[model samples]
Structures are given as C-alpha cells and as structure tokens.
Target: MAGPGAYAAVWEPGRQNVTRYRLTPRGWPEGRRLRLAILSDLHVGSLHVPLSRVSELVAATNALAPDLTLLLGDFVASRARIASDPSLADLATELARLQARDGVFAVLGNHDWWHDEPTQQLRQGPTQVGLALERVGIPVLENKAVRLDTAGGPLWLAGLGDQIAFLSRGRRPRGIDDLAGTMAQITDDEAPVIMMAHEPDVFARMPDRVTLTLSGHTHGGQVRFLGWAPIVPSRYGNRYAYGHVREAGRDLVVSGGIGTSQLPIRFGIPPEIVLIELG
Candidate 1:
C-alpha cells in the first residue's frame, strides 16, 4: 500500500510542504501526554528511493523529540534490484539512527515480502534485518508485545506480523491474537494500550481494549482527486487512507508513510512522518 516507490503523496492544506499529523485522543489520562512518531514503507533498494531521504526523515523525527517512535513496516523493497543489492547495508544503517524516548518498535510490510522472496527462503524474512536493527538497539516486534515504563506509567505495546504473510502462505499470519493477551499481562493502570500494525485492514476486527492503534500502508491511495482517493488497496478501502478512524470504540492513526516504492514520482500525495500526541 505504499506509494509508487515507498512514500505517500497527499497534500496537507495550508502547509506549504506536506505535513504529518499530530493526533490528540481522549481518555489518555491527565498529565500523560505522549508524543509518538510513526514512519513506514522506506522500500530501500529501489532506484526510485534513496537512503538520504530516510536519513533526512530520521533527522526531522529526532528534532521533534517524541516520547516513542513506531515504524509500521516495509523497511526494504523485495524487488529484484534491491533484493540483490548490497546497498541495503547502508539503508539498515540509516534506519538505526532514529531516536525516541521510550524506544523504536517496528513491524514488517508487504513490499518486504515481495522483495525478499520469502517463499524461496522459507524462513522468517524479517530476522535478517530485524537482527540488524537490534544490533543498533531497535526492536522489531512480530506478533509480540513489550511493555515500556514511562513517566505516565507502563505502556503495553503489541505488534502484529505483516498481514501479507498470509497472502503468500495461504494461512493467517502469526500474531492476530496477540493483543488482548498482552493487555491482560500489563499491570499499569495509567499508561494506555498501544498497538503497531502495518496494514489497516485489521481495523475491521480490531480489539477494543487498546486505547489507540498506529498503522501505515495505504499511502493515502497515492493520488486523490476531488478530495477522494480512488485507488485504495487495503482491506478497508477508502476507510484506510491517512487519518483517524474509530473502530470498536478505539482510535486508529494510519500514517501516510515516508518513502516511495515502485515509482519515485508523487503527484497529490506527499511523503510524511506523523507525530501523534496521546493525552
């Protein structure tokens, strides 16, 4: 669902350049404002996208000084060019530079599967890059959960594997049932629940226990005409563009993501790195 190469191309009215969203949701507890940055779909390795773009994105995000950082997926392109290129080494290095208060959490994306040829590998594709990320201190979560203790309290964060994994194997991806159980394990009564998922399609069956869900994969349909994005690919259709939606009494923020994929050009849609404030 990332744009042509690896970014979103939507315009934010009044902002000279494209801008990411800063969402503030209710029931977030008083004096517990949490600022989170969400970036996704870098699709590194394609000629369409360059490593410098992502380095710039990290610089901009660190400048914001967010409480936590969440990476929603598609860190690399599985296309032939990138799949076989050694340039991915630099791409991984650039991503490891991102800084956040609590820490950075990531999930995998469809393009990752597409480029990696996971079928041939018959192994957990993210492990290679995931380990690389860990070498630099970033943690990749696949159908797992981690609790972060912040000034507000302990935040129970859960991540689901790339839903596209099912498309290749014809079976449900691993972490569909991870959320509720993770929430049950967290003892914090103040810190709210958070989840990072790549595709917004899971919105249809999202659990209500989590206070907010952060995702990216639609790329705002890459092109919007007459205020409507006509080619939405995620399971939610137009419902999965760049914005907030209430599902089962919980809120979801789907970022426009920060790179391009198959094609480098962006028309109405512009790449964005979102900032979400929960209080």
Candidate 2:
C-alpha cells in the first residue's frame, strides 16, 4: 500500500550523514583532545542495508581520521527464518578497513544475539559475530574493558553485552548489564571511561565513574515527524532515543545509527555516523 516516495525512502540505505559533537567529561584531563568515530546498528543483510554500503561506510569513517573507532552493535538483522546471506567473515573483512589510532572495538546487539530467533533456536550468532570481528583484528568486548594509550592520555574503553540479550534467550544471557565487572579492569589513575552499550536504557543505571556511554539501538525511532518519533523501542520510551543527554553526572551519546529495523523506511530521521570529540 506504500507509494513510490515511501519505497524510495526505504531503499536508500546510502543516505547517511556525519554528526559531530564535543564533550568535556568531568574526569577528562585539561588541554587534551580525543576524537572518536562511532558506527552502530549496521543491520547488514537487512533490506536496503547491503554489503556494498559497508565499504562506503568504512571509507567515510576513515576520512574522519578519528583517534578511536567504536562499533555499537547489531551487525546483522534478525529474521524469523534463517537463510544464507553475506558471511560474517566477509563483513568483518570489509569493516577491518576502518582506521583508528587507538583501535576499533565492538559489542554485540540484540539482533546479533537473536538472529536465529523463532526458527533455528540457537544462540551462536553472537559468538560467531564476535569471532569474525576478532579474526579481523577488531576486539569484541563483552562486559569487558580495555585501556588505550591515546595521544591525549590514557583512556578507559568499556563495553557491555546487549541489555536486550539479558531478557532474550541467548548464549550466557544475563538479567542486567555488569558495569561493575567491566570497570573493575581500570585503576584509579586511569583516564576517563567511555562505555559502549547497545541500548541507552543502561544510562540511567550507570554510576558517576563512567564519563560517557555510546549507544545505538533505537535508530532514532526509525521514523519521525516534527522532530518527534512515533514509535521507539525502549523501556524509557523516547527519553534515551537519540542525541546527547547528560544524566547521572555523566554523558551519553545515542547515535541514530546506520540501518533500520522492523521496517526499512526512514522519514525525517536519517542514518548517521557520530563523530565525538572529547577534551
């Protein structure tokens, strides 16, 4: 029943934008700057999100020349039935082209965990996706943290498992995110902590120790009218749906993301790759 305009909007996956922001967290050192490029919700194998777009995305991110790169999750879209699609290895190979001084890191998303839902009934997708990314030299952090020695200073990067995965049937599912366990890896003298979580709902539960959290699960409601999205899949509704928010004495950057879910069309809310600069 949709018209030509609707189909055009849904099929134009190449329509992406670069969003930039500057943040100076509480614990950040004085007179130092760090640039981080974030790409999220790249629902590859989904309608309109083809493998070719992956190459273009990589090139665009590299052009930004960020000090660090973060992938927020949902590399593939979930479907009721399992079928042959682009191999994760191939996808990883293309994503490996990303350039960052510190490194490129990632976390799993709900779709990655539920890729086989209602059909194959297996939870191996997340593990396989992680392995593929790791094989390509990208570390997939699952409730884990790492310290990167950037030009600005030492930075603590932490990643948590998908909050939705905690409620879904998946490999080693948990009821809630383990932020404490991930932060335990950092010491007192460590630099500011930046956490990557799939859903922004975890922002409300985070402690002050976390300086920033990056997420991309809502897709900015996937559709919008007059700057308000009609439908958003979050426990907090549109509260953490998109853009930057300061909460719990910390900062959260929720990317609109580069792919669609449930439906492929987007109106008003275009896909984006976030460029965050911290000083």
Candidate 3:
C-alpha cells in the first residue's frame, strides 16, 4: 500500500527511500539535451509533511545536475498553511536551493489557492519561494512560456496555472484561452515544446503540438495496490499513477511527488524525484 505522498519503494542503505526516474524521448531535436528534474505535490505544511524528506529530495535533484529544474505546483497544502506559517518560508528557502543551468521554473498548484488572496497577496506565496530562487537567479513561470535558446536553436518551456485554482476565480480559460491555445503560440520550427501542468488529468485537452507534458498531482495513487491505485481523484482513472502514458499521441509523465496530503501514510508508494533526459 502507498500513502498520499508515496511514489515508489526501493531498498538501499542510507538511501532506502529515494525514488528516481529517467525519461528519454527519442526523435527529439538533435544537439539539444534538456535534463529536467520535476518535483510535484509538495504539500509543504500538511499534517504529514516530513521537511527532512523534502530536503533529501532536493539534494537528490541537485545531484542529477540537470539543465533545468521544474517545480510542478502544490507547493503548499492550503491557503491557511500559506497565511499562518512563516516556517513555510523556510521550506521555500530549501526549495530555492535546487540548482539548474537554464533556470528553475515553477507553477502554482491548487494548494496555493487556500486563502483566496488577491494577486498582490497571492504574489507572496510564490514570491517567498521565488525570491529564494531569484537569489540563485531562478525564475518561476506561471501560465506562461519561456524560450530557451540552446545549442539546438530554440526550445520552449510552457506552464499552465492550477486548473482547480483557475476555476475557483470564475475566470477559467476555455477553448482558446485554455492550455491548448497557449501552447499554439509556440512555433513548431522551434525545438520540441514541453509543458508543465500540475495535474496529469489536464493533459486530456492538451494540444498535440506539445511533445512531452510533465505533471504531478496524483502522488501515484498515494495508496496503491498491485498496479491499482484506489485513491486517485483524477478523471483519468489509475492510468495517471506514477509512470509514462500516451494519450491522443502525446507523451505524459506524471511524478508520484514528495510529501503527503490529507494524511501521512505510505505503504507501497514512497516519495520520488524524476529525472527526464531528452534525446
């Protein structure tokens, strides 16, 4: 059985709890290799959050020496957590410690929506985290895209805001305003386009233009059984549990994520960090 934040279980001394995944996409543009490390569903201040565990996760990500680092949202569990604790500030600092060459980019997760604060106040949430990254010169991307002019010419990294959070504002983007439309702005001639969506469920409507989509909202079922995860609240069934899946011709990799939410317990699934190597 896996807990709400469990990704996978492996046995190793002093590192018995670390989970890692390598994603190699063949047919990618030649000369451009983007090693992206994805950390998702952190749920920083929830009941079962093990700050020490996240620290190790961060250390693991840095050890990979990726070209870019991406934080896939759910930084905190709820609005109350964001507003009440300055300790989250410490967690934000720890996350800021992740290193990347191109830069570290982040998106807002549903947990960041807890207090319903205005953008001014909302800015504080990521700011606390972003400022930490900025000190190291990493930029966070939210519902936006950044073009990386690499040796391969140019590549674009796009990020979409949290779906549940966007819906709560009664201003959810539909049709053209959705992610598919935003992805359209990236020209195909550029290097392959990659998207960072918080939840794997959002990929259903993702445009075919995207070569690979990275997300982490399911926590790999948090509690799973023999390839069957029972607690997946996703619209896509257990298919979203911790691995690679093809949908409508696009590739999606959903990380199991680090930290727990609602409750802290893991049986089969443990926390994990994903390393994706783009060929």
Candidate 4:
C-alpha cells in the first residue's frame, strides 16, 4: 500500500490534463465544426480538490476557446462538513469566469445531491449549490433542453438530473429527471442533440435522436493498475466508467473528472478536462 504522502504527491489539486476527441456525427452540418469543453467533479471540499483549484480549472477551460462549455457536477466532496466550507461560494465565483461562445451549461451529480446522510434531519446542499451556479450565470439543466443557434446551425442541448436523487431520494426534495419530456422538446429539425447526464449508465436508455452524451461521475476508477480499475461506481461496471463509447450510433464521452472521492489517491488515472470537437 502507498503511504499518505505518496497519495498526496500524486493528487496535485490544481493540475489538469487535457484530453481531446474528434467526432463526426451525421447531424453535424457539412462544413461546420463545434468545440466543446467539459469540466466535471471538482469536489471542492476534498483534500485533493481544494476550492482554490477552481481558478486554474477555469483558466485552462477558457484557454481552449470552446464554443460551448459543460459543467458536469460533484462541486462538493459530499462530507457533512461541506456545508460549512466558505470556499464553496468562492469556487462558484471562479467558475463564473468560464467563457464560451454559446454559453456555460451545467448538471448536478450524486455528490451535489448528497446534502445529508439518511440520519440527518435536513437536506439543503443541492439547492444551495444550484443557486450558487445560477447566480454566476450557469444554467443548471434538470431534465430540460435548450436550443442554441450557432454558426453551424441550430444545436439542441438537454440534461438529466442526477440518477441517485431520482432513484434513492424519491425526488421530493428535487424534481425527478424526465428524459422523455426532455427529448420531446426537440423538434423535427433533426439538429444535433447533445445530452448532459452525470452518470454514463443513462446513455443506455438514450434514443437514436441523441447524437452525443457527456458525463463525469466515475473519476476514471480513481485508482487503476494493470489496466484494471478495482472499484467503479456504475451499474454498467467498467463499460461506461471512462472514455468514448458508442451505442446504437449515439456517442458518449465520460470524463475522468478532477478531484478525489472517498480516498485522495490516484494511481494511473489523472484528473482531466475533456475537449470534444464535433463535425
């Protein structure tokens, strides 16, 4: 087993690796290309992902000059003490600096919904986090879709709420994610649809209309050795744990995400920001 210092050395909080991918989808216009930057799983309260790192992440993402920026969730580490973390607000402030031609869009994650343990009397973390991002002009899409007119053409963007909240929390505190309703908003225009879902497992249920899906909850197994991850938090096992996956002609990009969860150790997989080019 590695010692604590070794783990700390490997978990450089402000370090970010950029992973790029190029995709050709049938829905994309012939001569037009769109660049999208995905940033996920900041986990601000975690020792391996301090709130101070938000500025670095924002700078790196802005430098890419993507047409659209997607903020996949896990802003907080999910510890009970996170409620008291003063840096959460500051993290939102830094995130507000993120720039894109269309706009900055976001979706919640399991950690963002984990406001309290079952034993706690009150749960308010999810609401607070959403409000923070909205205050900074980041629209948090919860089972809703938006249409953006880009130079290429009309683009459809839809997002689902964190699956954990709908499946476990009963959705009373927050509304349930309606994938069907979200897709219904897409007209017959046949524009490219990009769905933002925190968990990649949702990709399996996506219809053919969705051209691409983006997610970042696995943390790329957080620890991997010999090309095998000992732990992956997904019902689909390692199938959607990381990287680009295509199913039924729909593409899914699962980011490894920045920050540690449960443990502050990363072996072979480093935190990353995913840049996707679609044409």
Candidate 2 Cα outliers beyond 4 Å, as residue runs: 1-8, 11-13, 80-84, 116-126, 166-176
Instruction: Write down the lDDT of every candidate, Cα atoms only.
Output: 0.68, 0.83, 0.67, 0.81
- True-structure lDDT of candidate 3: 0.67
Alpha carbon lDDT of residue 16, candidate 2? 83
- What shift in Å separates residue 279 of candidate 2 from its native position after superposition? 1.6
The better-scoring model by lDDT among 1 and 2 is 2
How far in Å is the alpha carbon of 210 misplaced in model 3?
0.5
lDDT by residue (tens digit), candidate 3, 65-151: 888888987777644544544465577778878888777888766665543355334433443444444565556566677788753
Per-residue lDDT for 141-254 in model 1, tens only?
877777788655677788877666534376644433354554556565655778888888877777666678888888777567665687776756788776788755678888
Q: In model 1, where is the ten-residue run with the lowest total lDDT?
A: 8-17
Comparing candidate 1 with candidate 2, which one achieves the higher TM-score?
A: 2
TM-score of each: 0.82, 0.90, 0.79, 0.89
Q: Assess the local accuracy of residue 279 in candidate 1 as a C-alpha lDDT between 0 and 100.
A: 63
Please list the residue runs of candidate 1 whose C-alpha ends up more than 4 Å from where it truly belongs after superposition: 1-26, 83-86, 118-120, 123-126, 166-190
Worst 10 residues of 4 by lDDT: 116-125
Candidate 4 residue lDDT tens string, 1-279 = 567457545644346799999998656678889999999988887776666677778888999999999998888885655455655567788889999998899998876766535412343334667888888888999888999997557889999877776223544334356789899888766678989998888898988888889999998888776766889998788888888988767789999999888877777778899999888
lDDT of 2: 0.83
Decide which is better by lDDT, 3 or 4.
Answer: 4
Q: Candidate 3, which ten residues in sequence have the lowest lDDT sum?
A: 7-16
